[model samples]
Structure formats: C-alpha cells, structure tokens
Target chain A: MTGAIKSQSGRLTEAEAIERAKQGDGEAFEVLYNLHKRRVYSLCLRMTANTAQAEDLTQEAFLQLFRKIGTFRGESAFSTWLHRMAVNVVLMHLRKKGLPVVPLEDTMETDEDTTKKEPGAQDASLAGAVDRLELQRAVEALPPGYRSIFVLHDVEGFEHNEIAEMVGCSIGNSKSQLHKARLKLRDALKKHRAEKAKR
Target chain B: MNCAEFQKALPEFAEPQRDTALQAHLRSCSDCSLLVSDLDSIVAAAPSLAASEDPNPQIWLQLEAALKNEGLIRQPAAPLLVPPPQEGRGWRLSWALPVAAAVALTIGLLVYRPSTHQNLQSTGKTAVTEPAAAVQTAAATNAGINEDQDLLEVVGTQSPTMRAEYAANLKDVNAYIRDAEDAAKANPDDEQAQESVMNAYEQRSMLYEMAMDRSLP
Candidate 1:
C-alpha cells in the first residue's frame, strides 16, 4: 500500500488517491467516488432521464471502478477512463432492458435521405430561442437511441470515433445519429415555443 | 451549391475551414443558414448541460455497505463518518448482490454437461455458450483445470479494460472454491460441508461464464 501523499493544497492528488485506492484503502476509494460521482450521475441522469435509475447506475459504476482500480495503468486520463466505464455501465443496463442504444436501420440510411431537409426545416432557428431547462426536457423526450447518441456527442463532448467505439457503431453512424438528434431537438424546441405562444 | 449539396457537406463545415461553395450557399439560402446557426447554437449550449449535479448522499453509504459485503474492504470497528442526507428518507440495503449470486449459481448447476465442451471448442467460440454452463461443466469434469486455463488464455486476449477485472475476479473465486473444497474434504460426512463445496463450484462456474461474456468482441 502506498502512503498518502498530498499536494500544496493539503489534499491528496488524484494520482495518490488512485494508488491508495488500488490498495483497498476505503478512504481513498471514497475520495475517488466523491470526485467523480456528480459527473457520472449527471451522465446517467441525461442518458436515462430518470433520477433513481441514474443514482443506481452511478453506484454501480463506482463499484466497478473500485474493483478495477488496481488495473488503472493511467494510459488515459482517469476521468476519461471512468467516463468510459460509466458509459458502458449505462449502455449495458439499457441493453439488458431491451432498449435500443442505436438502431441499425437508422444507421443504414442512404446518404440522400441523410442530407434531405427535415420536415419543418424552414422554422425559425433555435439560436437563442430555447432555454436550458426546455432543451433538457426536450432531450429527455427523445427516443432512447437518439438520446444516447445526442448525449454522448453533444452533451458529453465525445469525438465521433470515441462515440462509435463506446456505442458499437461506425463513425459515420455516430455522426448521422448526432445530426438527426439535433434535428429532432430543433423540432421539439420549436413545438415548445409554439405552445408557449399559445399560452 | 444547392441546399442538398451544401447540407451534405455541412458536417465537415463544423471544422474551422469552410469551402467557398458551401459558404456561397449559406450566403444565398436563408433556411440553410438558419439550420447551420441553430445546429451551432445547440452544440454550443450542450456543454452547459455537462455541469455536474450531486447524487443523493445515501448512495455512498449504500455503496460502502456493498463493498464490505463483497470482502473488498476491511470492516472498521466503527462506521465511517459521512454527512447525513438533508431529508430523513431511510435507505434500504439491497439484497441484489446475494440474489444475483444465487441466480448465477443456480444457472451454473443447471447448465453443466460434459458433452457441450467439444461442441463449444469445435465452433472456436466458447464464449457463445451459456457462461455458467460452459464454466460449470469445465470445472466439474476431468479436464477442468486445463479448460479453465484455456478460458483464461482467451480472457487474456480481451482488451485491457476487460482483462484485469476478469483476472482479479477469477482469482478471488478460485480462492473461494479451494477453501470450500478443503472444508468438504475435511468433513466428508457433513451434508452442509458437501453443499458448501457445491455452491463454491457453482460460483466459480458463473464467474468463468461472466469472463467469457466480457471477452467477446
């Protein structure tokens, strides 16, 4: 077991904490959990749109991290590694529940349809039109496959290649899914705005 | 450039440089321009959503209990201190861990058959078999150790992320099986001892099956 080492701020650096955690230090594990829990939970919440399920998934992700922390060779940033694990955990749960993470037919769309104008493409631009809360609600209402892609690409800032690897789709499919997700979200925001005007 | 051509190339425009044809289309077409603007705004606003929100504090407590139950951590003489949740909602410790183990064990015992091994190997895809069955059958018959070694070799070929965890878990389960087997041998007449040995083998079989599933591409 490695001794606890602290930086000038008198707190254990993430590296030191990881080392201690690998040794099964409970406090070190807690430290790592606290550091990453909110982000992991937020990811789960966005993907599932259910707080309780997100919480459960968050717990499961951390448990997995603890079990595998000894294997952390630091090849990538810890957050990146953890997020990948978190994403896999959520994806596996969704898969077990029989939800489509990415529909094969959607990914197989011809280039012509992929580039064709979406319905109501002439609507006012969503630039500055939708607020954060409304956008979030709209995101929650998206189909499971679209929501997963949108959240991973747009919200989580993963590259198309990374998203493809994580979700088991081709890079082209990831991009197409993200674009379609945006188009759907645009339609949703426009509908919300129209409803607000009626009110 | 027509709307179709411009939109076809739009995803590439996300990069800093935009070609003159796409630019010219954006200049002439209001709808295409608005589509670009809207997509950009959506992309811009997306990052704000990444701002982290804390989960309920009880989650850590529940997680701690689970880790302890798995023998992954030492039990402290006293409960570790943590801040209380703002609400008085009582959290229940889940029986999922034990229940899942029991289910896996049942599956392992039910699926074990000696004949399936040759079929699995013939396909060159042992992972395709029901994990518990493949593992339980392997562990039960004369070729148990060699089959497990072969499974471990397959596991070794998996990606790094899956490999370490599988190795660690298999090591733990193997130790558990040894302990149970020794207990049964030391008390041959005890039905409880015999049952413990059976349960331990079941657990080992399930763990091997889990490893196989994870090893799949």
Candidate 2:
C-alpha cells in the first residue's frame, strides 16, 4: 500500500482526483463536486429556468457523477465528460416530466407572425440597444430547442457540429435553430427597447 | 445575393470575406445592413458563462453524507493527516488506507502506461494528449517529493506575468489541493476518493506546467 499523499506539499491534479473518487474517496469526490458544481448548476438553471430545480439537478448530477466516476474512461476532457453527463441528466429529467425538449414546427419559424415587425431589420431598436439583462431574460424565454441551441452556440462556445451531436440535430438544423433563437432574442430585445422608449 | 443569402452569411461576417453582390446589396439596402449588424451584436453580446458564481457550500456536506450512506470514504481519520481546514496550513497530504491503494494504482498506471511517461517528460513543451493517466503520474511524481523547492523550480521557470497569474490563481488551486488533502488524510478508506485526489493533482501539474511552458519563447 502506498503511503499518505502528504497533502501539504503536493497539488492535486484532476486525473488523480477522479481516480481517487472512483476508489470511493469521499473527500476527493467532494473536491470534484466543488470543482464542477457551478457549471453543472448553471447548465441546469439555463435548461430548467427554476433555481430550485437547478439546485436539485446540480445535486443530482454530482451524486450521479460520484456513482459513475468509475466508468470514466478518460477518452474526453473531464469537463466535456461531466457536462455531457449533466446535459443527459437534464434531458432525462425533462423527458420524464413530459416537458417539450424541442419546440413545435411552427415555433421553428424565424418570425411566426409575418405581420410583426422584423426584429433584425430594424436598426437601433434591437441587439445592442437592449439591456444586457433583458437580453438574457429573453434568452431564458426561448423554447427548449432554441434555448439549448443559443446557449450551446453563443453562450457556451460550442461548434455547430458539436451542438448537433450534443442535441441530436442535424448541422443545418442547428444553424437554423440558432438563427431562430437569435431572432427570438432580437424580437424580445426590440420589444423591451420599445417599452423602455415609451417609459 | 438577396436578403436570405446575406442573412445566412451573417454569422461569418466577422471573418473578412467580401462578396461583390452581397456588398452591393448591403450598400443599397438599409434593412439588410441593419439586420446584419443586429445579428452581429446578438452574437457579440452573449455572456460567456464560466459558472462564475460558486454554488452553495452545503452541497459538500450533503455529498459527503451521501457517500457515507453509500459505504464510501467512511474511514476513520488516520493519525498522521488530521490538519483542520481552519488551520490555514497551505497544502497537506492525508496518508490513509485508500491513499495507499491509490499509490498502488498510481504505480500500476505508471508501469502499465509507458506512453504516459514519455508524455509527462515533455509536458509543457507539447500538447499532452492523454490527460487521464499521464497527467496523474506526471503530477504525482513531483508532488510530496521535494515540495517547496520543486514548486519554485516549476514556478520560477515561468515569465513574470505568468508567475503573477499563478500567484493570483494559487488560492483556488490551494483550496482544491486542500480538498484532496482533507479527503485523503481525513478518511480516504474508499480507494475511489483517493484515486480521484491523485488524478486531480496530476491535472493541476499539467495545467501548471502548460501555463509555465507557454511563456517560453
């Protein structure tokens, strides 16, 4: 048996921590939980839009992370691996509740109502003009598919192909979803701006 | 290009690619140009979330209790590794039964994985591909052996700016290291947790080395 790790002198690496967690090191598992809880919670919050649910899911994700720590083959980045697990957990939870993971076909339209003004074509009334927080709220208001695409592409910096693989959509569909998501955000921002102007 | 074509290409507008027809359309069409600019801002204004806000700390206790419920990491604290968290003693190691198992595992990893050794040798110089085992062995090798002098050698090699950045980030690193220490020293009977501690250290070393190596000309 190898001696104690002499914690004072040596720094912990993620790989070492994961191996320890797999061996049932509760403290090592705690470190892993601390390391990733925020991102996991943030993802849950974005997906669920409920802080309590997000917190619950974050806890659930870590619990699952520790349980499944042994199966981690080290093929991908731990962050990627953990995020993927979190996404799967969120998706699974959403499915179990019968919530919509993808929006209806009608919602896929960039502008469902032709009569409504084109949010993108309007200068000074959209995008940069909108409050940052308002824009984020607008994002929060997006449909499941739109929100996931937007978060994965813009906020999370994933490639379209990666997004497609993650969400099980075609690459073209991913692009179209992003476009629609942006359009929705722009429309919401435009409305916020108009309302602000009136005030 | 027409409005749809221009809009489709908007995501790539950040790249300097000129389309004569697209340029002509943008030049003549106010609506198209406005839309293009709007799309650009939508992309630009997105908040790159890093989970900046730490989650509630109670989750740690919850997680630990849950592990205990599952029969993991429920070991009695070893005699040698009982440094309290409030002690502010910097980095420390917890030697326990699970940690001993992890040492064996680390040795097994080192012996079984030869490529990892080669990868460790030139860590900062090249991109380290196999992060799992390779990072663990490399990081663990340096840890606990020479402690202060070794850290100086690694940190000392970095550029001043990099060293400053390392100093700034050390608090978090120390915290992480502290977590590993607490687990191993306190109650790492569950070899899983001990293994995780060792892997975390390896990854930290790889990151530290990678950061330091980047500053080299």
Candidate 3:
C-alpha cells in the first residue's frame, strides 16, 4: 500500500481512495462512504420522497459504488462522478417501478395569472412559522422528475451542466425542466394559498 | 432577454455574481423577487435524509457481510501447484499392492489378456485421464500472468476516472440486463433478442458470482 493510498488525514486521497476501494478495502470504502454517504442519502431521499425506498436506494448506490469504484476515473471530482452514479441509481429505481420520467402532458400550460392570486388565510395567518413546513410539503408534492431537478439545482446548488450530466439529459432539457418546474411550483404554492383562503 | 429566459436564469442569478441588469430588475419586480424568496424558502426547507436513521440496518450488514464475505476479500490465490502427484515405484514395480501380489493369479488373468473385455475394464481404472480443455485454460492463465507486469504497474496504468466510469458502466450494463430480462418476460415474441439478452445476463452474472467468490472471506 503506497503512502499515496493514505493521504495526510490517514484517509486515502481521492485517487487513492478509488484505488484502494478497487483493491477491496472495505475499511477504505467505509472511509469513502463516510465522506459521501450524507450527500448520497440526501439525493436519494429528496428524489424518492419515501423513506423506505430512499434507504434501499442509498444502500444500492453504495453497493454499486463499491462494485464499480474500480471504474471511477478521476476526470471530474469524485463527488461529481459519484453524483452521477447516485442519480442513476435513483433513475433506475424509478424506471423499474414504471414511474414517469418526464410528464410530457404537463407543458406548463396553465393560463391562470398566478400573480393575481391572493395568499390564503392559512398562509396569511400562520405566515413564516409554518411556512417552512408548507414549503417542504409543496416541494415534496412536485412530480418526481421535476422534484429531482428542483432539488438538484435549487437546493443542492448544482449547475445546469452538472445537473444535465447527473440526470442524463441534455443541458437544454435540464434548463427547460427547471423553468417548467419553477413555474409549476409557483403555481402550486399559489393554488395552495388560495385554497387555504377559501376555507 | 424574455421573461421565460430570464426566469430560467433566476437560479444562476442566485450566484453572487448575478448580472447587474437582472439584479436591478429582480430588486423591483415583485413577482420575480417573490419567486426568488419562495425558491429560497423551499431550498432552506429541503429535507435532509440521513441513512443512519433508516430502520433496517440489515442492508449495511449484508454489505459488510458481502465485503467480509470471504469471497470479496483479495486473497492472493496461491498458485494451483500440484506436487507432481508423489510418483511411487511400488505400483510401478509390482503393478499392485501387497494384497494384489497374494492374489497373483487373479491379477494375471485380468492384466495379461489384451483381447479380453475384462482386461479393458481393469486397464481403464489404472489410467487417469486429464481434460484437455482444463489443461489449455490453465496454460492460458499462466500466459496471462506472465504478460502482466507488477501490481503497481497495472494499478498505476488505470486512470481514476476510467475506474469510476468502469464501475458506472458495469452498473448501466447490469441495469440494461435487468430491463432486457423484464422485456423478455413481458413480450416473449422477441425470442431472438431475448435469448441473446439472457445469455449476456448469464455471462455477467457469472462474472459477479466469480467476484463474489473471490471476495468472500
């Protein structure tokens, strides 16, 4: 084991982490897992919504990370490469379940001038306190495909190009979906507030 | 730029270096500003899922087991060395054991008659036949080992991105196999591709099995 395999932190460098992982160092892998597990799990959870499925997805991603770590070339950041892997794992799960990839029927065609809608009684009354919880629910309510792009770009702060690669779509497609997602979310939140006001 | 274009670019605007024009407009445009605020709240409220909180830890346990599974461990397969099967002179000299000498007449009748059916059966037992294919495969493996240089050279040669991509590609291939299998089951009319798909799956599964076997504790 070269010292390069173990960086100054006694953990392997990214390159060495990959090399050692390929050599089947479960401990070294545990180190790699420790480094990225949270981010991986976060992506899985936000993408899938269901905790149970997210857990399974997270495990599968790491097992895959273990099985396929040998092929990780350091062209991009290891996290960037792994982000692609993690995203693929989620997409594969959705595809297996026959979940919709892109809701083509939803073309952001709603004509309602959402800006004209008033904030609802609930949103108006509780205001900022429950706003966080409501916002969380609204995001969770977005379509899976839209939610994923929304989470990656809006929440995780990945660039469109990066999201494009991670989601296996063209850069233009990522941007469009993001635009559509933002529109739909704004519409949904506006509707939620209006419906609450009517109550 | 159009509002649609500008709207899509709002995320990019969240960057510290937003274009001055967009920043100025967003400051005054309540709709766009509220949209940014709403996006901000949504992002701030984004749920954080920790794998540690998962109810079933068995998957990790299985993974640890898989890792610890004697099969996954990288044990240097001590070269399959046959100690030349201890050749002895007793079987050579007497052609038998002490009991065989005592039963000399029976041995003679079985061994001496070259044309006899009984003699053929007895001779077959003494001859140990090795498989040609097995021998050839062993030879090929030996040649492969000779071709490979030291471990470091082989490891050093592979780029890290290649390794990660290789892992990812295998995953993609595995997923394809899974999809093909599902397709085959759903629409058996595509029998030709189905068989080919199944065969590829079997081959890949064998590779996984072999890896698992090698890595097992």
TM-score for each predicted model, relative to the true structure: 0.61, 0.59, 0.50
Best by TM-score: 1
Which pairs clash (backbone N, Cα, C closer than 3 Å) in model 1?
A: none
Candidates in order have lDDT scores of 0.66, 0.58, 0.52
Error of 3 at B55 (Å): 8.0
Q: lDDT by residue for model 1 over B161-213, one digit each (tens)? A: 22333344455555655555555445444454455556566656565545433
Candidate 3 lDDT tens digits, B91-177: 222222222222322322232223342343467832332243235334533432332222112212333322332243234434544
How big an interface RMSD has model 1?
8.6
* Per-residue C-alpha lDDT of model 2 across residues B3-25, encoded as one tens digit per residue: 66666665544431276667788
lDDT tens readout by residue for model 1, A1-199: 1222353324456787788777766656765775677579889999999879998999999999888888999898899889889999999999999998875555556656544554554365665645565677788998899899999988888888998888888888787677778877877777776666666
Once fitted onto the true fold, the runs of candidate 3 whose alpha carbons sit more than 4 angstroms away are: A1-17, A103-108, A111-135, A165-170, A183-199, B1-32, B43-56, B67-70, B75-217
lDDT of 2 by residue, A1-199 (tens): 1212324334345677788777776546645665576678767877777667777778888888777778899897888878878878887787788776555555435443522465444445463543344555677788776787777777767788887776677777777667777877777777766765776
Tell me the docking grade of candidate 3: incorrect
Once model 2 is optimally superposed onto the true structure by TM-score, how far is the C-alpha of residue A90 displaced, in angstroms?
1.2
Which CAPRI category fits model 1? incorrect
Of all native A–B interface contacts, model 2 reproduces a fraction of 0.34
DockQ, model 3, C-alpha based? 0.09
